[model samples]
Target: MKAFLASLVVALVVAVGAAWLLETTYQSTAADAYATNGARVGDPGHNLVGTDWYSSRS
Candidate 1:
């Protein structure tokens, strides 16, 4: 049980850290767009996300 708890905590920490890094990366860049079509940078209608959180709006 102790080992399980330790692993769980470690997993949680890693998950949180990864999420934070991804959020920061997404927010810091304006060239990337989280669109369903998966287009390249500098293309028209990139549908950029304005906020730090994930948005459904294109």
Candidate 2:
């Protein structure tokens, strides 16, 4: 039981770490693609034609 618990903990740690790494990598790639396409990162209206309704909400 102890060994199983230890293995489970290790697996959880590895899974969490992998998920974090992939998320970071994806964000970096997305930012690069956005910049390449002339869209400003983090801007809601970067590529939109009309006003960003979400940001314009009062």
Candidate 3:
């Protein structure tokens, strides 16, 4: 039982670390790709994920 608990803790730590690493990698890649194409990163005006329905522009 003790060994199983230790293994479980190790597995959890590895999974969390992998998730964090992947997120960081993805963000960096996205930023690099945008920069290569002359697009700005993190600009809400050019958000690709959602629409800005609240904007007052015509």
Q: Which candidate is the best by TM-score?
A: 1
Would you estimate the TM-scores of all the predictions? 0.47, 0.45, 0.46
User: What C-alpha lDDT values do all the predictions have?
Assistant: 0.71, 0.75, 0.74
Which order, best to worst by lDDT?
A: 2, 3, 1
- Which tens-of-lDDT digit does each residue in 1-58 have in candidate 2? 9999999999999999999988987555556667755675675546667754465567
Arranged by TM-score with the best first, the candidates are 1, 3, 2
Off by over 4 Å in 2: 26-58
Worst 10 residues of 3 by lDDT: 43-52
lDDT of 2 at 5: 100
Q: Write the per-residue lDDT of candidate 3 for residues 1-58, one digit (tens) a residue.
A: 9999999999999999999988977555556567655675675446564654565687
Clashing pairs in 2: none
TM-score quality measure for candidate 3: 0.46
**Candidate 1 TM-score over all chains jointly:** 0.47
Q: RMSDs, each prediction?
A: 8.1, 6.8, 7.3
